[model samples]
Target chain A: MPRVDVELPSVLTGLLGVPRVVPVEASCLADALRELSELHPTIDVHLFDETGGFREHVLCFHNETNTRWLDGTDVALADGDRITIMQAVSGG
Target chain B: MGTTAVIGTAKGGFILRSDDRRTWSVEGPLFKGWKLTTTSRTPAGTYLAATASDVYGTAVHRSRDLAEWEQVETGPAWPAAAEGGGNGEARKLKQIWTFGHGGNRTYAGVDDAGLFASDDDGVSWTPVDGLNEHSTRSGWFPGAGGLCAHAVLVDPADPKRLWCGISAVGVFRSDDGGASWTPKNEGIPIVIEDKSCKDIGRCVHGMVADPKDANTIYRREHVGVFRTRDGGEHWERIEHGLPSWFGFPIVMDVPTNTLFLAPLESDEYRMPVDGRLSVYRSRDGGDSWEDASAGLPAEHAYVGVLRGAMAADQDGGVYLGTTGGQVYVSSDGADSWQTLPVTLPRVLSVEVYPS
Candidate 1:
């Protein structure tokens, strides 16, 4: 099993109850997100749209690369890999 | 009772507290970075704020102390695209414009032109299927502001009697609670010239029902101001002395038969008439209008007030926010005005709560 760290923004900290960084044991990015969602059910609505697709304003990065531009959420994760979730600061 | 003003803006919401009408202290930018469309305090003292993120959809937040807030899980949402009768229209909840309270029930008028109801204190919401799934939903075209159900009125005399105003779709009234509805634009002016959709194309910019008499309602439309003596069954033009016929906001002092409107130049130039900022006040139930600009700017003031940006307190205080990021208050029934010290993001709504 690979242990990956997830970083959440300040806006979600109160709802999710997790610090800026939390480690979860998962073998792939998709599984790690699932684990995160299970721990924080309220956050799932903000992260995904009605069609189960990633929200347009949400950006997920697998280490330094944007996960959206990558192949898919099925990319394998490795020990010590970091995942960051952020909201795009575009609209009012 | 202490007074608190809730100002919703493009970036977030602000709460201004005042013990005396002379001075005030501001506290916010709450829900930072989100567009707050409206805020209302239920009779039970619970405050609900309608907020939206361009990406995360619309949400309803509730609070009791005005400090700690919790987002409601079951907010207004459109039917999934796949189940939307194959019209292929992308149904999204763009904004929540107004909130109406009746007994223990709460109603919300939202963009995409639909109504929603909540029973458990704003914690959850269910679409009013009668309005959302109306047979004429397909013919309800979007106006300049998009298809937005911006005003919802629940008759205090009869909770079963409800009225909702949607831009370019006219007004709809339901005598059987939320189970059924009928279009109520018999005397409203149709701005769109299409003969086929003449009856349903009246653009209602803002509407308010008399607090003392639910049967008497007034509305500011795309062409002019109108008043309905028989609920919304019949409307008559009331823009007799107004500087301009086009405007967005209408606030009323129900007990005094006083009304306030911020009229723009016209549909083409949606700014103050003649670049002069003035609020037209009708003290005789729209029978006559007067420029209530005693203290407001008189020169080169080009600002636009949105539909929900003006509000009136029970104590005769009138407040309005402009697109230019300015908020003005008039303590003497709109006869005089004073600008607030702070300037914020484009203001969307103004609400007053008396403690």
Candidate 2:
């Protein structure tokens, strides 16, 4: 079995009152997100759009590159693969 | 003139007395410190005002004679809860975004949260259930700012039918007098990103459902104005004739179902468009629209209407207050308009009461 590391973006870190960490045994990234969303109920509404996918404001990165630009949720992760979720910023 | 009208302004609130539906006089700038958001007259002709006052938290006031006001307790001074572990004060009480009236029931939507109802005039309030507290409350998403409920429209014929607007979250309907809500965005368009990112519905600002025809609803989203004929089941976009896609206030005439909105240039952050202030009107239920500013100021005026700053009276009259501190009045049902007094402190909202 492969173990995955999860990280959060600076914008989303403090939003939830509790510490953000979850362990899952999913084979792919989508399965991991789905599982993590269920484990942490608070993130279910904030992170997912009406369509049930990661919100546009949220971005997931595998290592330093955006996982979105990669193979998407289907991208497989081996041991030590780090997943980070970041929120986009907009201002005047 | 025989109709008495209460108008909300930026610096001061005003009460206009009119008879024969013609001439008018401004009556007030009451409550010197706070800015007025919206005003609704109860069944007994008692005026109820939802205000953003610094001395008081968000409060509602009752005016028996339409001249003297008595303060009434409203709700949580701020949007977020004390235990929410978030910056509740940052948003504070921006405005009393909209008003809903039915029988003895009166509701006001405060910034950051929702419909606070007053059963006996505007003296006291309790949070309406289903519309405000969904299973999704824990995760209610905020737009650029924190979460807030702006628009509240109650069916005059059926007070049980309620519709509330949440910015960036679409519209919610409560058939059981706001006990529970169902998202009415099935036919509404949402901006979905590509494979990786998902998109929510557009941020809704102001909405008006026909007082007579519950099925006809008009909404002004951050993107543009849309009309829903089937009680919000499906929406048809009507952005072709407007100056800008972004705007705040939308007023409707009950008799004709005509819709009026102030259009600004496209700015997701809700900024004035190219410094132009234009009011557009749709006569046939938003199918087609026309610019309705005949005697109003120039487009370069940079006057932008805020969330609750535009209102329509029972006499086919429309009024709008702007962020630049200005007010415009349309006596002929928003077909044409003229500037009223000079601008004042950012006008948060506007309401007109006609007797």
Candidate 3:
């Protein structure tokens, strides 16, 4: 079982009203999100597009660097790997 | 984990959320009718809320527990009508866009005029008479938004020296604590083609002063994002790694000086590259930038982040509310992000309470 650690965004933590960090089994980064989507259904709606591609403002990182700059969406994951999902927000 | 507060405004009033980086319980729709513009906590356990409504003039509300709210009407109130009370007509009362607290006084940037100051915790007010006395107000004009003061930076180390960014006016600095003001636009680029950009302040969308080093400041102008090392004396544009040079809302990690910006796609009015959402970050100030839009939607889409919709936490966490009624969160700095459940009619502002 590939161990995956989920880190909830600060904005989500406040909305859900709790700290969320769960371990799941997945072979790739996309699989991990699919598994967690079962727990937070709303997130999945904004994460994936009509063609099932990631949104433009939405960014994914395996560790600290962007996954797009690495292996695109085919990036594989190993046990104890971490993933983060964030979107762009701007205001003056 | 420390306490962080998130205040957002909508159709009815304001909502307050207190969290400890992990959990948060809703505290309010604190005030009614007024869309809360800004909230800043005072050292004496007091909180100030700047609000504006369609029916009433803009006013500052005060609170103690973040629950109960009271409108402060004694001090320099908004201009009254012929019979007294706020302008009885439509959209007449001024709007308070942003505010800052320094020493024992809290200053507010009221739309249509200059700044307002309060000494007794939002109880009373007096216009910073110097703004009228200043020789620069006449030269300062309104931008995309009507005449509005959207950003105010107060040097924590030196209360007397301060800077404010207005919509169309660019940036102004007052080193003698509002006694006088000057236009500081030396290296800032201007939109005009004939005159010198030095005399006029560049059109600024958002700005943040490093809490750790007051001398360092980052700003997002109508053209690009620029930083000043020796305060506003000089500036350098830094938009090499961003998707588009046009953007609003710039936030900094209070203790770390890390900067975050949300850029909109260029070549279009208010559209993203591909229906995507991307938030960029600069860890070492604005020296460099890295995109943190993983798990976000695609580009070439129509979604614009408005002013006052982005905020950050002391834990390196960032939050943003969009015009599409969506809120996104990033816990591990700006490395990765995810969507949140809270949706609003139209998110005017998003803030994270410090822990």
Candidate 4:
């Protein structure tokens, strides 16, 4: 298992009382998110819709690289990697 | 509690508390940065509000004081495999429009056109699939406001009987405690002009059932205002003494049996008629209506009210929040109106506590 730090926007902090940065151990972005939710289960609704897809406005980046631009969330990840997530629009 | 108005807006939500209805103390922008679509004070005295976030979709928040909120993770939502028409975004539960209750059951009318029920107050939810999976669901479409089931009315005496109001999909009645449903848009004109849809397509903007008589009910539709005496079995146009037939909300002040509504210019130009925002009052149960816009703005107030933005406290008071971000209050049963001093956000819904 690889270790990574996930950074989330303040909206999640304000609504769900989750920390801005959380450290998790996972091998990929998908597992990283799963572990993140396992730690903070309430954040799942804010990140995904009922069908388990990323909410339309949610944006995920893996170390300054757009995760969606990559082939899949199953792409290999490395230790000390940083995953950044944010709402697509600032005021929206 | 004397009277409090829970106002849901495009930006957030507010609470106005008044003892005499003349002076109110303002408390919000609650659930900051989230759009407050609808609210309810459940029969068990629990405060529930639906908040929609750009990144988070929508969820239910519970409040005991109407100021502090607790997020309920298991709010009403469509299951993963339940398929709905339109794009993937449209297939999801986008917004909550109204909250209703009868006996121990609490009902939620929501966008994406579905009904949900809560047995243990509003903590958790289960979808009411009878109407959500109706035979005519394929033909159900969206109006300008999007496809939504915005009104849920359960008979006062009989919890088994229910009527749901949906935009562009028409009104549906459930007599078997929501196990089954049937379309009930007999006399209301369909929004789509050409091809006739036997059941769906009638856009119900606002609806209210009689406080006493279960048979009597009224709804403001996209085409016109209508009333049904035989429990929505058949309806008749009741747009007399009004400037235009097109309107958004119809609220009832139960004690007086008086009904109040606001009529817009027309469907093409949705604004107050002639730039004068007048609330029409029907003292004789929609037989005839009169302008009840005293103390309101006289000129250039061309704002429209949404279906859930206008509310009657069911006492002598009626409150309305406008698209212009202004709230007006009438304490004396629509006799006069006064605007609140604050301008917040585009108001989506105004819910009265203890209503």
Query: Highest DockQ among the candidates is held by which one?
Result: 4
Give the per-residue lDDT of model 2 (tens digit) for B180-246.
Answer: 8887865556642223222234467778888778778888876668888888777788777776767
Which of candidates 2 and 3 is the stronger one according to TM-score?
Answer: 3
Better structure of 3 and 4 per TM-score:
4
Report the lDDT tens digits of candidate 4 across residue range B24-66. Answer: 8998778778899999888888899998876688888888878
Residue A49 shift from truth in candidate 4, angstroms: 2.4
TM-score on B-chain, cand. 1: 0.96
| TM per prediction | 0.93, 0.70, 0.72, 0.95
Docking class of 3: incorrect
Task: Single out the weakest 10-residue window by summed lDDT for candidate 4 chain B.
Answer: B81-90
DockQ of each: 0.44, 0.01, 0.01, 0.65
Q: Order the candidate numbers by lDDT, best to worst.
A: 4, 1, 3, 2
**Error of model 1, residue B127, in angstroms:** 0.8
By DockQ, rank the candidates, best first: 4, 1, 2, 3
Chain A TM-score, prediction 2: 0.76
As a whole number from 0 to 100, the lDDT of residue B122 in candidate 4 is 89
- Candidate scoring better on DockQ of 2 and 4: 4
Give the C-alpha interface root-mean-square deviation per candidate. 2.5, 15.2, 18.0, 1.4
Candidate 1 reaches a DockQ of: 0.44
lDDT of 4 by residue, A1-92 (tens): 88999999886767667799999999989999999999987788889987687887899999989877888799678999999998786654
Q: How far does residue B56 in candidate 2 sit from its true spot (Å)?
A: 4.6
